[model samples]
Target: MPSSSRSFDIAVVGAGICGLAHALAAARKGKRVVVIDRDAQANGASVRNFGFITVTGQQEGECWNRALRSRDIWAELSERAGIPILQRGLLTIARRPEARLVLEEFLATEMGRDCKLVEPSALSAYGDGLNGAAFAGALYSPHEVRVESREAIPLLAAYLEEQLGVTFLRQTVVHTAAPPRLDTNRGLIEAETIVVCPGDDFHTLHPERIAAYGLTRCKLHMMRARPARYDEKLPPVMSDLGLVRYLGYAERPAAAALRRRLEAEQGDQLANGIHLIVVRSADGSLVIGDSHHYAETPDPFAPESVDRLILDEYAEVFAGPLPEVSERWIGTYASAPDRLMLIDCPCDALRIVLITSGTGASTAFAIAEEVIGELYG
Candidate 1:
């Protein structure tokens, strides 16, 4: 049998970005940390995402602040861990006059610092192939960064293990978290404290706690495409559809008018929860996505119609011909309408944290710091 007396200062369940974030936080405090994951390697919504650390369009107050802090942390880790940041900054294309109004309204807020509304004539300076989009204006924010999630997550995990002395028990299913002992399939893992960062598979550890909040899973369809010709690099691009989705702009009074216009013009895309966020990779392939559908149990399907709608939005925002799709996949994450994330302290030594907003990549680092601080301090 396995050893039943092994222990750690902190035991983190689930080795996605959320768990790694907690591990990093604890390790920094000189705590002996052990992270356990069911997967053989890093594979989940955390790695399947665009790896965009967005600051400008997050919900105005706390989320935006968390994104800023997380972005700074990403910057530090990117350099220290040798993760290449593919792009810096965001270029939000305003396709309608009402969308431009939302941008202007956002610019007036404290959250809009270092962001400006750009005229169409200035769009070419940001990158190439802009003359094709039917844009009214654009919003440029210098505070965003994009990385290849497929590459960064593994690198971050390695850095944590080799540099910070964190332990990883991969492919080990954690059945219980009744600290200072975790009951796993492999054996018992003892720790003074436990934090659960279950990424959408809520039933594994604390189904009751997760269900109490009426949590559900949101499935998104994403695809990668190879652009026809290599041109000047383009920053991440978003459409008017996003103005009605991201709260920094969507929550504004001006967003109402834009929403109405979109409903009239692009009702199908809106109903499907389709938004355009096109970011280029280091290899000139553009990673684009995604449409949202929420259910208690989301089907693992990526519909062609959904992809068509996504491409339609892409065409509306960018002038060039649609690129040939190279890969397609679906990603699901814990989601809730009431909150972006939840941190429940079942006890002083146990914490259940879940990022319901699909913002795990964008915000988990700050959330981890908060959780660790509360548990330790």
Candidate 2:
């Protein structure tokens, strides 16, 4: 159903954060850019789950650096785009001796320069709602930032259109992304370069290219709860499970003991891939999640047992009654064991990228810069 011909310097497929980042990066270089997405608006992994742009626990080298740069971009663009920073910083509460050792070892790395180790007795000095938990200590890092993804995604797209002059072809499916030619439902678009940031839908444009990477989707269950009494000042919280999950800490030699201990004691949690990441929105409601389940096509159902495992971990960290469940949902994103993200160069003028590590919000901007830089040069 292609119509009239259109042209731009860059044509980006997918309107999620990854696409938006690429659009911004190219637009900043003063290139005329058009972003194409199948949906009328962003409603995928980008807008789901916790919008926590984490830095401290990313895999130490490239991912950690990318998170750092992306965090700075988020701070700047969040203000320029009129998106509110609902919260800042991360609190990883270590409840086990092995977890505490992982944190200590993490602090010794160069990546932990500005982070601090908070003794359990003084955890309240950092934040409230953690008095009853029997925790060893906590690692507080100022490098993390949180945004209301559901709100931020639209605002960012609007900012790109109204302010940055990037064009958007919403509800348009890009059937092909070959350089100098794009076939879409609206019309045929011609661009000198093409960048496909397909969030998790690997089969849309270049299924063969994506299949070569051996990628799968990871499904997670997330929930929103309204506390009996709301607190506007709760920072994002993580727990021991995260220490053994996030690569920055998990990759450390010390994490082996933590994983062993976790497996022996919290088998269900480990089996379910449950970890706690609780953040609050501006509306006084908390965004909490999540448990990881992997499948090529994951079941859409949100199991109660998995939710209970998440809540039980939450109860252990925060002192108070569990918040009343207000919202529950599931999200799926690309996952690959060998890479945090995949950048496929089908040719010199084309790129296909996917953030397989669920760090799209945390690393997309920096990744965009890298991709755009290479394409332009």
Candidate 3:
């Protein structure tokens, strides 16, 4: 059935990061935009994932460029929207010799040009409580910014409502049909254009449409550390344990060999699922995580063994007293086989977009630009 006698210019289903990106893009184009979601507040993967707008680790070429552009947009929005940037740089601490070699090769690439190799002597300036002994050196990328996602998502939603004049139908499930007619819980909504950004919950809405995408869910565990007064100057750091995961390293030929060696040497740890990323919050606390477990259905409970593995890496990296745990949470996101992000037009009026690789905060804005250009152009 037709929604109204008339139709909106654009209707966005799912108010997570991706959907919001679409809504923002359409609204910026001066289109009448409405964002519909089942929750009264914007949550899900957008709020659950790290609010780190990381440009350095993104895949090379378009993905990297998009992240860079999106990082700039995030900075602008943070300033305009009053969202706090918790930190502004990323330090990948190299613990293994192979990891160091991998990073050295990465520096030769175009992607690594913007980053600097930091020696132990310079580490004092970034943070004091950190154990420089565990690391040979680090690759410092100053292009990224971190925000508290728990706060930022709601703030972004509120900002959109107040500033962009985009209407939001909260606590509403929008059932979509061709030509973009929606039977929302609130009421009827119809649009000439429709975009769906369902995050990992694709099964709920368009299971058939997403099945061919080979969408798998990845479960991650994260812990929020209690606030500690570190030497006032530590930068956000990631362990070089899985340097291969980051694009800067992955693009280099050395990374392949290094990954193979690490996988063999650390086969058991890798099998058990262990990697290290330590990001600090605004209050001088660290948010550390995580392990990867891929499956169609993921248990929400974080495994103790995985937590132990993460902490073991953390303890190896930081020499100071262990920070207390303030909170712990589990997050899941969609993973695509080929693309970090999936953008498809199932029909002329319907666009299905997914951040298949959990890079939503880092690349959503840029992806939105691409989607909008495709639709409107």
Worst 10 residues of 2 by lDDT: 1-10
In order of listing, the candidates' clash counts read 2, 0, 3
- Best-to-worst ranking by lDDT: 2, 1, 3
RMSD vs true structure, all candidates: 1.3, 1.5, 2.2
- For candidate 1, the 10 contiguous residues with the lowest summed lDDT are 1-10
Distance (Å) between predicted and true CA of 376, model 1? 1.1
Which residue pairs collide in model 3, if any? 126-233, 126-234, 127-234
Error of 1 at 374 (Å): 1.2
Models 1 onward score TM values of 0.98, 0.97, 0.94
Candidate 1: residue 253 Cα off by (Å)? 0.5
- The TM-score obtained by model 2 is 0.97
Q: Write the per-residue lDDT of candidate 2 for residues 1-377, one digit (tens) a residue.
A: 23333788999999999999999999999999999999989999999959999998999889999999999999999889999999999989999878999999999999889999989888877767784358889999988999999999999999999999998998999998899999988778899999999988988889998999888999999999987764455569999999888999998899999999999999999999999999998888998888999999998898899999999998888888999989999999999979999899999999998999879999999999999999997
Which ranking of candidates, highest TM-score first?
Answer: 1, 2, 3
Model 3: CA > 4 A from native = 1-7
Query: All models: lDDT?
Result: 0.90, 0.91, 0.80
